[model samples]
Target: MKFTKLTSSVLAGATLLSIMAPTASFAATSKAGSADAKTNDNGGTKLPQNDHTEVGISFGDNNSNGNTGYLRLQAVPHTLDFGNHKLLDDSKLDFTADGKNTSLSVNNTKGSFNGTNANQTTTLATGTDTALDTVKGTAWATVVDKQVTRIDPMNGPEDTSDPTNPKPTSGFHKGTDSVAGTWTLSVQATSPLTAVDNGDPSKEIVDENGAKEEIKDAKLTFSDTQYAQTQNVLGLTKDKNDNTYAKDLADLTKQPTVAPVKEITKNVSTPLVANGSDITVAKAAAGEGQGANVFGWLPENIKLTMPAGAAVSNAIYKANLTWTLNSTVA
Candidate 1:
């Protein structure tokens, strides 16, 4: 019975070994299949998956946008009116006036009366009618208001009118991006003062002998010149005492400030000569005078002077003036 039992135990052990061997072989085959799958995935071919798009832009003159990258002269005076006067005598008469008032009048005449009859009382009339042996005259000039600008091509224009955009303030802040360069404002008289007959627009005023009358030595003076920025980049501030001052906030030595419009002939009487050299009224040097600037003279400071002898007839004398703006990098 012991031998039979031993033999049966051995057979059971053999059956268990056969089952374990089959299970081990199946596990090894499954692992190999998994390895092959991983290898195939890593080596799988890939096709290119790329795409493309495009972008574009354009520029133009749009007034609402507040033209940027430009140095511009925005405003100027249109007329300098020298009021009416009388030629009572042949003595040299000087007529000084402004955009509003006049220095010489019927009662306030300047210079000595060189008439042969010193005691002769002459009736001074204030109308367009030509009195006996008396002359009524008016002097005026047509001034052209030139608006000039220089644009930079390197940068796109900015819309300064937008509230969200940065602007030049009163304090010492970083300067706004602009077309940085040099510029000048100049004036010239294109023609001499010529007297025209009031009765006929096409005819010139002539003397008793029909000689064409002209004022060759006529002069126009501009003073108290001032400048302003359209954007109000630099503004005025009042102190405790109510004294006004320029609000300039720049450490001039370090970074360039938006330069103030400088009057080259400030407080000086600049002559307006016909067909003469250009007179620079205001100027901005390199790294200065950015944005829109305007140059103007005080009404009280604008004066026109002419010799009394030039008032030969009862007529209106007219002249032409041209303003110029120049922009440069140097």
Candidate 2:
């Protein structure tokens, strides 16, 4: 019985050894596979759809977008006062004394005065010292003349503290989107200079033959005319030696600036007849008169020539002058 039991135990131990041998072989294979394992890495990339953006612009006082881009008449002379003239019996009513008439003065009823003599009032005849006393006669008919694309109204309280840098109560600004183009300025006499009856202000003075007393063959003349730009791009300025020169405000290396050196039309001695056609005083070609420009006329140069023997009268005579500005040059 003991021999048989020993044989069975030996067989059992052999079976257990076979099972443990297989388990050990599987563990050894797993460790070898882990030590020789390989790994992989991945990468990704992206691109932008667009790289830029755009902006828009426009001009004028029509919109509330704060864009100012339109041609405008900034200022003009409202009154060209030829002071009271004493009607002499034998003297011809001529103010054209080779542009030396001391009786002529321009009263700027419109726009700001930028003249060196702003408060100067000329007293043609002897009189009391009044505001009108400073109405001094000048050889030049100076007006606050400006032609611009845009202008700004007085924004806040004016600073009158400094005289040299007198803060302009009003100013003009160049439009960001302004288109450079041509322009024109013209003048016309709407009415004839007729004498008003002494007895009646409404009625005209008539002669013995019932003819209306009028200054016949009278001509308005302008001489030594010049135009200046606020930006100083183009204008006529005099040197210290009284020699006039065309001021070029562009770089010397670039093309010359376009401007007028003389009057557009020679309406010098020609009569500006009543109800006559429009006469061009000044003009600007394409790419010329841009930004704020001023027109200066020698006051003495602006004269009225009256022919002799135009019927005697002790009455006041009056006439009307109409100035027109057009965006497109004619």
lDDT of 1 at 241: 15
Predicted model with the maximum lDDT: 2
* Highest-scoring model, TM-score: 1
* Tens-digit lDDT track of model 2 for 215-311: 6666666665555443321121111211111232232234434443233553433464578668777676556655444554545556766666666
State how far residue 231 of model 2 sits from its true place (Å): 3.3
What is the C-alpha local distance difference test score of each model?
Answer: 0.44, 0.45
Error of 2 at 162 (Å): 61
Give me the runs in candidate 1 sitting further than 4 Å from their true place: 1-69, 88-92, 96-103, 107-178, 199-212, 230-257, 267-273
Model 1 quality (TM-score): 0.46
What pairs collide in candidate 1?
93-308, 172-249
Q: List, residue by residue over 1-330, the lDDT tens digit for candidate 1.
A: 999999999999999988888433332234334345454432433323357887855221111212222333333444444554445234434443432224334533322122122211111111332221111111111111111222123334444786788554423223323334456777778766777766554466778898765677767777655444422222211112111111222312233344544545564343445676677776665555443344445444556666555545656666667776676433
| Every model's TM-score | 0.46, 0.44
